[model samples]
Target: MTHPELVIRKAVWKGEEVDLLVADGKILDVIPSSDTMYEGAEVVAAKGLLLMPSMTDVHTHLREPGFEYKEDIASGLKAAVHGGFSNIMCMANTDPVNDNAVVTDEMLRKAKAAYPEGGPRLFPIGALTKGLEGKELAPMHEMAEAGCAAFSNDGLPVKNSELFRRAMEYGSDTGKPIIDHCEDPYLAPAVGVNEGEVSSVLGLAGQPDVAEAAQVARDLLMAEYLDMHIHLAHISCRKSVDLIAWAKKRGVKVTAETCPHYLLLTEDALNGYSSDTKVNPPLRTADDVDALLAGIKDGTIDMFATDHAPHAAHEKEVEFMHAPCGISGLDSALSLTWSLVASGKITFDDFIRMWTTAPCETFDLPLNSFKKGDPADFFLFDPSEEWVLDATTMHSKGKNTPFRGQTLKGRVISHFLSGKKIV
Candidate 1:
């Protein structure tokens, strides 16, 4: 559907207040906020709000095709847009598992059906192994051609090095990054909490930081050996950070991400035995958090991801030991990450680049260029708005967020996709 010529006036973008002109679902031009008037264009006053490209999450689990009760494509896409994200790349951990072209095409079709015109785009990441079994490779090239943005074996490590090598080689051919959830299963058989003083205090099964660091070390070595790019998912420990830094210094093709929970909260949050705090490669110690902050500051860590794994209320309202490992991270992602900037841990530039350009560059996904003829995928953010998070009210079906009761600093007020306002 074609949209009328529209001008968003007085929106703050790139530290300057400018007027954006949109036509035919693309940015027509950006003009200074003068008395200049368009004769017939529909104009929406932005009220001097922060205007920027909508965020992109490279790691999210929408739970579609099989787990609609947890979160379907419609609900997940809605959640992404509400979180000020226009492009989200979902992992291949669905019930049917998006390993083949048919599944990938179907997911894309469903996403388009949900948002026929302006949409929060859904990019599917194909599974590295068939059915995510870590066995033989899936028809990855077929899936990539179908519409997959990247390849991954999330929720499980591709433990077999030989198979992982073939998958990386395949990813190289396809020009997409291979996202890996680094973990040594044998070492961390139980992952209720971080293995340390907290686990000993809570008497829960714990996963040590080394379990993740060990896999990261192995993956880095493999990436260096093969001269292939590997994206490490959810680095929660200092050991992993050190290894990633070593790899980057040696010019290894590696990019890494960490979740908001890891940056702000720690294993101490698990002391209450809340299942929401239970994430795979579980939250690490304060020292690890500091190390992660350092990595983010120095550019060792490439971007931020929600790892937005959603689950049913009953699923998370169980014993900590039995509850699934994940956090429904999309809804409040921007606000929480902005807090890091608010505290001066990372510069505002780093925050913007990580959320917008970094993930797009890392995964080879589409991004808003904010230039003439480019799709106008943008959002209006209120940086000073403080709102208490209510997980049950979030757009995603699952209400399993660790930030459930906390007050966050920033939020999205409106979103425009391809020049049409969606939220």
Candidate 2:
């Protein structure tokens, strides 16, 4: 018998039926009800819901310090918690650009200060190049000492391969990851939409698939050469997925992530040239979509990330080619991922790994699982409940979401962060 602070009976963990007991923000015990007894604790009946380890988004843009018009740290984090995330990593592309130790430190300070009453943990990433200009490397050691969670040059790829290799070497020495936005500017010059029949029909400039694959190839080779950890962000092209799979099989020290948009939407989404579907490493063909989802199933893709880029109304409300690239994905990422699993495309256990375990491992966060002594960072969701996204009422300050009006299967009934209810 154990006297826990709270007990959730009939929780589904790792797809198995179990009772979860929690105390002081950590799981205390899990036992078969027939062999267990609770003395005094608050009970939550979780018969139909899945008790998943807290979700983590390794790719998200908070748009703070300068782009408050789009989103701020507080608003972005609030949206994340409501969406059942317990930990999230913010990208380094910001106002001052989190390239220097000072800017990186400020990002971390503001993120810490913006913690909601009960919300997901925020981890700030530092830039790899000074100002992310790719002309010169930033002070990697200094930013690492300042508590940056990782090093990245997201949103912009380092065009200079030599400089990128130098950054990788520095990152390896410092034990920091180089998260790259892999898109070769040369192969996909002046393109807007994905290179495909859809783009051809719409008369839009095509962003060839080689753009993404070329960068992934270069970075993976660099990572292997340097013996450094490299993480590719928002992979979209079919060849990009195949390249990662090939590198992983060859034992390269590489890891990568793809966004929900890539898995769920295709270049067909860009046929109308709606800015909402516009994203960096722009959405690709249906073949690319199939490959992305296959990568998730086969473990080639490390995890699912939102790549939750947000933009102001004016920035995205204009005509097709003129609109900025991005989509707000934090809230809709998980539900859509779950739907993919529920439809038998992927197993539930595998889905959990992508959303929970894999992400924490990628970012070097504490191993979060539904086990005793682990933090009570969890999301309780009725997997059967239907949900329709509504950006007007979302917690995010930015209202640009591509999944608006889309129906999803699961709903987060409640979320517990540090043993306290948040949603």
Candidate 3:
């Protein structure tokens, strides 16, 4: 008999009662649940817990090669594995920016050295424009060769239409999607609050939802015009959803994603005047959240992403207006999304599809097939487990989440990569 390295007994995999055997850091087989056991193998009894494919995040900020103070590749990958993410793509908004091959190489090197014992894999997203300034194009082909999965100008939207069009044209040849932060800089309000009753109540300048929708419309047209792929990042409001739905019907080569914050929280969160609630494409109204949910159900949203933007405490501790925009959400995004499933708002299939297959297919990242020779990257999750969100609970160095102090359900019990438990 072939000797297996490890066996997880009776874990529910895709709703099937199965026994998983791993060998040589790859899945050897998944047999029906049985008492027959493999001798001389490390065994884990995972009855009643979920054995699901680890998640893939298309958007995250590792903040290395510059702002390591907020989060470096090591801390970010650590947080990712703890969050059950086996594959994560980091955005390019560093001090020097990941616009060229050198910065891309630096990000790749840092990721390579992180979690050598088994951790989440990181893919760098090179800058769409030089310095993320929107004025000059970055070296797309060079960065692509340096291991950039995609290119993005996250946190800095390119306002010049012609320049953005030229960047997209250049990006098409890289064989990597150009992910866009869809918010019109000129129309976006300086304040982080969303335009709504809560912002009026707080007396804060509110960013209109049109700021996102207008840019979405622009990018959709650009995708249709250029006949190229452009992925929209962190879409927040209803109008954008409607536009995407229309574009999809018309066969525009566009894909979009919404963060957990937009699906779960509304602008009402800013009533406390906490800087933690502040995020770009700030949380919108219940009506907007409803639209986003509907978009998810109908397949217009394309996929789910955390937009796990982390910020230093000092960077977010100032007055709400002065504080930088972001939420340290890698820790809470999964559980909050699971809450929707637990509440019957979305199905288990929808959850798994959006979290795993959808994003991986969208970005061309590898997805765990749980088949023989497939890398053993998966997790055991306790749906019954409930815990509170706090500084200690988060693995990321930045603890700027608005969900802090809230009790959350569905915790990851064990995270395994390459047939070994890492968290």
Give candidate 2's whole-model lDDT: 0.81
Q: Please, what is the whole-model Cα lDDT of each candidate in the order they appear? A: 0.87, 0.81, 0.88
lDDT of 2 by residue, 73-170 (tens): 88898889878788888888898898777876787677778863546777778888888888989898998888777888887788988988888888
Q: What is the lDDT of residue 311 in candidate 3?
A: 92
Best by lDDT: 3
Model 1 ranges off by over 4 Å: 1-4
Model 3 lDDT tens row, 1-423: 357889999999778999999998888999898988677899999999999888999999988878889999899988888899999999999979898999889887878788656578888999988999988999999999999999998888898999899989988887889999887788754467888788888888888999889989999999999999889998899999999999999999988898899988888888779999999989899999999899889999878899888999999989898998888878887899999999987788888888888888888887877878888889999988999999889999999998899999999999888888988
lDDT of 3: 0.88
Candidate 2 lands at a TM-score of: 0.95
Q: What is the lDDT of residue 287 in candidate 3?
A: 94
| Rank order (by lDDT, best first) | 3, 1, 2
Give me the runs in candidate 2 sitting further than 4 Å from their true place: 34-37, 116-118
